[model samples]
Target chain A: MDTPLREPTYLILTALAREPMHGYAIIGEVAALSDGRLSLRPGTLYGALDRLTDAGLVELDREETVDGRLRRYYRLSPSGASILAAETERLRRNVEAATARLRARKAQALTPRTAGGLA
Target chain B: MNELERRYRRLLRAYPPDYRRERGDEIIGTYLDVAGPDRRWPSLAEAADLGRGGLRQRLRAAGATDLIPGVRLAGLLALTTAAFLAGFWVFAEQQLPPAEAGVPVFGPFVSVGIVAWCGWLIAALVVAVAPGRPARVAIGVALLMTAAVPAVSVLAGVPRPPLLVLAPMVALGVLALAVDDGLPVLARVLPVTAATVGGFLSYAMGVGAYWGAYRGGGGEFQPPIGTVLLLVVLLLAIGLGMRRDARGGWAAMALLTPVGLLNVHLLAGAVDGLASGAPRPTYPTMVGVALAVALLGPALLPAAVALRRRLGTPSAAAPCPTCGRHR
Candidate 1:
């Protein structure tokens, strides 16, 4: 499975990692997770959904009646979960490296001005 | 339900033809079901948004190969340009050194030049509508001849006038001959009205200045040659401006005629030992201004007629470089 995914795709996969839901429900979940930082236009949403479907990481699970309208539910496949895990691991490694560097820089700043070091 | 379906149907039009062919009805049905009574009639803003999107999609689907429609549009534009130019030329010609003035023999040549140009424009339109290898070749050849023929005629001492005058004259005449191309009439109307208004304003200014000088006991004013030339140029520019097919910014520049000429006159008058201020409106000066205005008035018809033809047809938008598609 391809481990790297676009941020939006990763978020969508993360949302579906819990349970299958329709397009609108998934949009709401993603918005909730992002604290309303992201909003999707219908065209963009559908276009992205189409591309994701072709990638096989996401699949249409079922059709449901929502407010008396037909809605297709989507779910992340097992391969999607593995890809999400890999992305998380990659993020974790970057964070660890950055944190270590920040701690070393902090210690160095605290060491006060020394004539020998300046020279 | 009906209104919602209609709205959805309208929205579905934004899709390409192939997409519409496959899923138009389904998409509308789906949208109707989703929207239900909650949304009801679409808002005016939404409708406009949908229309713009749909038009873009339709254009994209139509692709760049639809030269036929554009050619038809161009034909109409050609007619409008021709009509406007012709009217402007006729109206402006009266200001030219009258044949009786014995300035030169460029007078008769101007009229003939206009007629011949009109003939070429008519031929171009016929060819545009009935385009093919032969028609294309004919149009190309005609355009070449139209460009070259006048130069030859002039060089051979056939009395061809300068292109500054000939350009507008030919444009208007050609538009007239191609009037059948079905360009929108308003394209010519708006510009003519604008140009007319501008010309009238300049004339009015000239007259008012004359009246002021006449009353002020100022020195006798003589209309400068540049002023006369500027007036003539503006009259023709007005005709050009009247057409939608005319270049943008052209109409605005036409209004600047008086300002331009005044600037030239202001400098030249001082250099030539005249007063350092503006030209005073004396009897002879008023007469010159009035005469120039009157002479230009007759060209309105030919200008309108030519502008009408050109405006009826417009050109295609610039082509996209990457896609080789017209916008």
Candidate 2:
């Protein structure tokens, strides 16, 4: 892929990774998972779902109604799981690399110069 | 249904009929799921998002491009067209004295026209970036404002450009349906770029042809630039079509190849009329020339390319590609 998964796409797939969730549930779940960092509107969320479904990363799991509203549940497909895992690993590696560099810098800063007090 | 739900349903009709049929209820259900019972209307942000989304889907389904690319194409075309016009005026202002000039009338329109052109480019950017209903409307309005020059000129009996007329009309249609959505990037930009370049060059060269052919003032006037640009575009399109199965190539050809032919048609008629100091192509030969170019020119290139490709194929003797045999 020319680009990594966008934040919303990544989060949407993450929400479905746990279980099949309907539209409203996915919206709430994404918000909660992101600690309210991302709030997907209905239009934006649905458009993403369509794109994901078309790409075979997500698929409709079931349909139901609660309180007279149509609810179409979606789940991550096997391919989606594979993609999520790969993305997670990629993110983890990036995080680790940055953390390692920061730790090394901190240690270097704290270390006293052997030759002089302020070389 | 309550008033809000009914109103929302009306708004949802903006989506393509098939798309709305597929997911309209699901979308509406989502909207209501999130909305409070007391909420009477969708928020402006919500409406804009929905409008953009619907237009995006419609454009995606129709054009061979997605939303961003479509927007990019629109932004570029808008900017380019604006620049082309500005450059023309700059050239006119610099090269010729006010008392004697061969360019179109820019006298009264200089005030609003310049600002409108600037806003036109800005509106194009807005349409490209937002793709919302308001943005489209804004762009369309700006285009119409800039286009008022030609429109008024036509009403007051002055020569006007066809591109200025068609660009806004087509742009409005594109704004309504969207310019891009599901197609590839080139599928988005190629046809747009070709048409803009063709239009720009043709408009200039057509006027040039008119001036040179009839104005009793020509020691050395370069032949219409649009003619050469059209031939190059046509050949490039054919070459691409021959090499790869690309809708964009053919689409570009369809858009780009016509300008020079059109300019020829206009110039042919312009000469016959202007030489007599009458602004009508009344002669039969002039009418015939215009008719031939209008009828034959656009179709001729693609047909020729397709025919050449068909003939070049080694397996015409075999059964057809899809069916068992040719009819």
Candidate 3:
């Protein structure tokens, strides 16, 4: 993907990275992964899944019936995993740079001021 | 089905029937899994999301996967057409005989129209060079200036171009602003250059035709060869483009809509004149209707193609023989 992946897309991919999961399971995982900062509605989740599936970033893993209702499982593709890894690296580097800048600023602030001729 | 399931199903119906048939069960199942046992209705946010999703799916089903590309193409063609027409109109206005004495033909409205055309020309150049937000801003300004022509004319009681002519130019300007990013510089420049040359040729040919008629003692006027050649070239280009991509057809339609509108307006005027027993009774009602149908063809062709594609595809709408449920 040339453009940066959107937050929901990234979270969804991360949720699917561990194992193939059904729609509801992926939604729950995404919420947990985001620490409840984000919630995946069924419509929004399915829409992203459709786009990912079309882009070959995600694929149908299986379909089964539980409690007389159909459930379809989806898993991240190899391309999706590699993309996620690249995005993670990119974000990590950005965080490192920001952290270094903050550390330097703190060090500068904590430095002692030299006294003038009066001292 | 429970009340929640039933409501969710109702919301799911917003999708295209084929999509609903394939994904309805799965989508509803997901909603049911998420819903509490006692919950009876979908929350407002969920309903809104479902509605938006369904519309997006419908647009996808209609083969409008990404409208930006098509819109960009349309905008380029539309702006080119508007610039060419405006340039030609400005040139053609100069050919008219001067007004009698102090009674000016169009008064200050002509000057205003010229300024608007200049704005369009500048906007075209901006699109070729600057693009992005700059191009959009230029087009927006040009559109406003162009729209002001009729408004000023109406207020000042001066003759103005009919709304039929001015409307498409304004629409084209809006279309040009629909996307901020621009095409390649060559892509943007070539069309504008071609249109400028075409406009010049049209003006020269029109003047030559007028002079020829005047010199030949004026019987029936013949269509200018340049105009005929231009039309043929335009049709050929569109045909070749359509052979390559579907966007070409849409672009061609966008380019031709103004011409279509003008033709229809002219036809209506001729019909009215004939009914009122004017000197020339060339166009009949049948001819007008035929022209109207021809005008409608470009607009209808895509819808027809989309419908055919939808019906021709074997969808999951059919119920399974054994299970008696849609697959």
Candidate 4:
């Protein structure tokens, strides 16, 4: 079995899941998706990009020059898409189970006998 | 270049030369794109990332220096496992009276297994020296022999294989298939040292006769718990000292040997018990086998991915010897 994608890899794939993006665009999107929790520095982002490209999970889509700087676009490969989907499903199941348990605990707390203690 | 770009360019030297030639400009461009105009130097996180990224690339490049690290490591593992198995079979053949030993003993299967082992040993040696299509074919045939021994026996109406005997063969096939043949073959000295250490472990564990072939309640049945614990500790050390050793396959093979033994013990017990019309051993051993398989599952995939990158890289060579003569 393949190694499960790490948080950064997952986030990067998520960013590219919708459409191809340049390096800075991916960093911004990853941060936005995480609600400012993940701010990918260029070094980290490019390193990941290079590794991902090497692994065949991500590929360069196009390259254009903006303000005399190279802006290379990358998109998730088919394998990358499936990996992201599988990881998402796993996380969703975990969250669902945790929320279900929490809801059950809350319901138990709302029972009449438990409510009388607060009164 | 401006001062900040110049500084970043200097730091880029830490990356591999080939990598720098390919991706350096793009990296520099990305850094400039993200850098604030007021920023004078790289952030600590950025510097750390570059250091790590560069180091990772360098380490990978080192694998390509002489031998393809992936294939050679796989070859070493195949070689050592064959040697270990061959040595044990020799000992078991010399001693271990048949009356004391039961159906699932080494001597029963050793003949064909020895052939396989010898083939594997030769394949590994070939992989070490030749690094060509023939060596790869030899490795394939050797691994095939491992499964074929048991298979041919069954076709000849022999009793079903002691599953423990089968586990390592299965693992060898799986791992061998996972490692791409395109990677360089580096001859790491540590694997030899690790093999010596493994020999010590074999001697200490009474590896030839872990259980079976003894009077009464059978041979010394030291629970796999100790083996498992030691393997875990050794694995931890491997991880911690990864910097010391670039080829992770040695520790991996060392770990696989015992896990293979434990798996054999568990499955052999079950199969032999069933064949003899006795109750198969219990849950704990099954769980142990399951746990070992689980640990093995995660270890293989990522290494395959990494090695595939090394092997599949267009310029790693003029296409590995499969389609053409060896470079």
Candidate 5:
């Protein structure tokens, strides 16, 4: 089985799922997605991008010059999309399990207790 | 260029030149985009991250990712082996009877051996609790002390440890310095502790057997069952540990090389004694037979792993869809 995607890699793929985005845009999107809990520096982001590209999970979509500076856009490959979907399903199941357990505990707490047992 | 741009470029020099040429502009653009208008310098955390990233890229470029883990495991195993051997030597010497009247109890060679053994013991302790740099320094000092044993023995014209024993100890000391910084403290401590205990027990049994033979007027000493069992258990553990991946296989090979060499030496001695019509050197013969398992054992696992991987991979005869070349 494939290993689960790390949060940064997952968020980067999610950002590119909407449209191919440049490095800075993906960084901003990832930060916003995580509610500002993660702010990827240029080096870290490029490192992850390099690894993903080598793994055939990400590809260079285009390159452009903005205000005399180069910007390279990256997009998720088909394999990356399928892997991300599987990871999302795994996380959703975990969340559902936790939520169900917490709901049951809350319901039990709210019930009126008899002398020796739950009412 | 502005101050921030110049500094960021300087930091980018940490990367390989080819990588810098390819992605320098894009990386610099991202940094500039993230920087505020008033910012003049790169943050410390950013510099550290870039440095780490650059090192990772260099390692990847060198194809060292697979070997580094193996080398690290070799280091841990080597440290354990050295400590075990040193403990064995010290405990065995302690088992020797006191010198007769008007004779020195410990020879110069034995004294030097004890010092070297103590150095290895201290090094094992320091490596368990200390961080990388200090652990490396400790291993270095212990290696130097171990080398001094043969040197001092040769100069003083005293009986010294065989090269088969000293060479492995020295090699292990050097390998131990290759330990990775990321390994937990407990992982480093457990093996050394276990080996030290095993060493003491083996030597105690061997020396006890030697004394028993002398007392019974036996012509030759019998090899201790405990020591033979210890070696067997060590080889078994290494073999079992190697069933996982090529990394484990590589580690097993590194750790076993010394043991294999010693086995070869023992086998040669046994063969020579038989050829010369000497009373069959029972100890070397027995030990040689027991340790012979290590000689060709470690190589098999890695070879199998490689073969399996080769069989599972697609044939190179297939043409690449994009480039129209063999993949």
Candidate 6:
């Protein structure tokens, strides 16, 4: 259960958690979901897919021919879902920490006056 | 289908053989669907990039990050083989003379047999581990060294022990084959063996003459002195290279150990011959030795380091995965 959550792996796991999708579809969805922040180069995409598939966090749901081209659809396995939940919790904690730091900075900035009157 | 298939196959070449056999077609099929028929021929750069990608895939499949570690491992194995062979030869020689009442049966046989064994081993190792360019250089050096052994013996009035040089050359050939990464072991070994034999024959013929009948061209082949000198110098250069590198440990010694031994055989015979008042100062022998040391010493000396780096490095081609070999 060492979290194998590299950026691409995390993104892929997040995408597969939604519904089953083929390789290309997953590529498109990930790009769209990340608003172009994440692009799936073929090499990078396949590598991530292979790892996820191996870890049992993703499973090939079915095979299909769209426009007479073969593609296998992948869905989040139960393990995948659990891992995603853990990742989400981890991310949430990071956000909370950041928020607290920001609030403390704001409070310091808003103080009426400091001893040096630099507030 | 034709365009796609060709491109797919081309890309597939990057993957390791096992991976390609397992899923190359399937991966290509899926790619075709995604890109559709509209996808034009990949530009040269695109193809190159795809090839790199394919390499990465193969690397992942191989469960290894780089080939450097493998090369290091290969060098170690080679060193071990050299040590084992050298030790056995020495032990056999030491034990045989003492035990035998008259003629030492085991010592000569073992020595000769070992040289042949070493040649085959070095040849095999070179072909297996070394690429085309290095393979050629290695084999050439080996053949030259082989001839040098006998030439030195003849000039210095040592016993005509063919096996002394032959065994080490054979060992080196096998060593070469054992480390080959790409070429078939057979391909590397055959050329090396043939070249070694050719060199040996030429040396035997040249030195076997007493500078009387075969003086054709008045001077070109007059004494066969040049060839003899060349072999001696070559042997000396290789010997020096091996010794220098031997300081680096097994890899260095593996290459140097045979040459060192051959030098021993040559020097020992020379010393004995000189002590027994073999001959007066022959111009040819002096000239040959002088020219050999002159031509070979400087040229081979500089290259000694490079040869060591090529043969001595743990893995010369690939960087270490976790940290670069340099780091």
- Whole-model lDDT per candidate: 0.46, 0.56, 0.66, 0.58, 0.66, 0.49
Poorest stretch of ten by lDDT in candidate 2 chain B:
B214-223
Model 2, B1-327: lDDT tens digits are 777788778888777676676677888898887886998988888888789778756544443323244234334333333333333322222222234554454454322234454444455445444544655576566556655755665676653333322232333333223343333444434433443454455356545334323222111121233344346545655765686534335434443322423344345546665655534444454446545655664565347455654556333343321112331
lDDT of 6 by residue, A2-101 (tens): 4636667788888888888877777788888789887775555665666566567777787766655566678888988999999989998999999999
**Cα deviation in Å at residue B314, candidate 3?**
5.7
All candidates in order of DockQ, best leading: 2, 5, 3, 4, 6, 1
lDDT per residue as tens, model 1, B22-91? 3344334444543446787765654554554454334333432122233233333433333333333333
Per-residue accuracy of model 3 over A1-119 as CA lDDT, tens digit each: 44478788999999999999999999999999999988999888888888787677888887899998889889888999999999998989999999999999999999987879457
User: Could you give candidate 5's per-residue lDDT for residues B1-327 as a string of tens digits?
Assistant: 799999999998888675677778888899999986799999998899779777655544443334456657767776776777666666654544444423223453234466777788888787778857787888899899888877877787554544445655676677688777656778778546955885666565776333223322122321232234236536645674677434554565555554544344344446646645544445555446435544454465455445644665332343321122342
Candidate 6, residue A80: CA error in Å?
1.7
TM-score of each: 0.34, 0.54, 0.51, 0.45, 0.50, 0.40
Alpha-carbon error at A84 in model 6, in Å?
Answer: 1.6
Q: What is the lDDT of residue B33 in candidate 4?
A: 76
**Model 4 pairs whose backbones collide:** B67-B184, B67-B185, B67-B186, B68-B183, B68-B184, B68-B185, B69-B184, B164-B264
Judging by TM-score, tell me the better candidate of 3 and 6. Answer: 3
lDDT tens string, model 3, B84-180?
7666655544444334433334543333466777788888788888877788888899899888988887788765554544655665676667543
Tell me, by TM-score, which candidate is best: 2
- List where candidate 4 sits over 4 angstroms from the true fold: A1-3, A114-119, B64-315, B318-327
The true-versus-predicted C-alpha distance at residue A61 of model 6, in Å, is 1.1
Q: What TM-score would you give candidate 1 relative to the actual structure?
A: 0.34
Candidate 6 residue lDDT tens string, B1-327:
678668767776886665565455556765665566677665565465457667555544443322322323233343333333333232322223333335323334322333433443454356546755565465455445544555654575543233432443344444443343344455434444544543444344544221211111112221232233234435544664576522223233334433433243333435335534432334444344434433453344236444554554443344322112321
DockQ of candidate model 4: 0.20
